[model samples]
Target: MTAIAIDHDKPDLTGDTETQNDIFLQVFNSGDGALFDRLYRDDAISNFSGEPLTGEARRKFFVEFIGAKPVLEARVTHSYVAGDVALIGVDFSVKGTGPDGQPFTIEGKCTDVLRRVEDGRWLMAVDRPVAAGGLLPE
Candidate 1:
């Protein structure tokens, strides 16, 4: 996808860290798998289990994962934006029973990079998650 030429003069509050965090919340809360398609570009990349995903593969991952979860929530800790790139540091906790009725909870820290597209739409360019303070090793 072509990158948008950001207007540096005007502060991009929309693509700032807070806005990125909001976008994440909105998509997850909507539970509409298509939301991913709208929020991500065809060539957008993501870090899932150390594997990169692009195009339809990325959308399918979220659809299947979220569909299996009873609930999911993301909280932002800090964020910043530079030109066309927005960086967000977040703390997330997900609680849900798996498809097999196995209950589970995970706490983690996530760093997300959102890029502005040529069409002036912001989409997730990258998402990296690190296990936070909990039973999981960092």
Candidate 2:
């Protein structure tokens, strides 16, 4: 079966990380990994598992992560922009059923670094979600 793509009519990724946050949530909830990946750079890093993951590892992780059919909620806590770069802080939660058929929920805050490419589109360079105490194993 073929799937049809929908145009959300949202603005293109620009200098507004605030609006991008909303777009991120929408794409995430849609569970379209290919579309979701467009929000990040080719070499982007995601610390979702408490370890920095990039390259094919990151793509594989995201594929599994999205396969859980997780639902996400994110709120932009703070954002700062300088030149072609931006840093955004977000509080978020995700709930879904694991591959083992167990229900799981994760709530945390994330720090994201974004950069505007030559085409004037902002993409995440780093995405690191931290626990409440801001601690991760060394």
Name the top TM-score candidate.
2
Assess each prediction's global lDDT (C-alpha) against the native. 0.64, 0.76
Q: List residue ranges in candidate 2 displaced over 4 A.
A: 1-12, 132-138
For candidate 2, lDDT tens digit of each residue in 1-138?
Answer: 122343443224567766777777777777766666666788988787668888788777777787567998888999999999899999998888988989988888889999988777788889888866443452
Candidate 1 C-alpha lDDT tens digits along 18-137: 555555565565565555445666676766434677778887877776656445577778877788887888888777676787898767887778788776767777777766544333
Worst 10 residues of 1 by lDDT: 4-13
**CA deviation > 4 Å runs, candidate 1:** 1-13, 132-138
In the predicted model 1, the residue pairs found to clash are: none
Q: What's the distance in Å from true for residue 46, model 1?
A: 2.3
Q: After superposition, how far is residue 23 of candidate 2 from its true place, in Å?
A: 1.1
Candidate 2, TM-score vs. the true structure? Answer: 0.84
How does model 1 fare in lDDT? Answer: 0.64
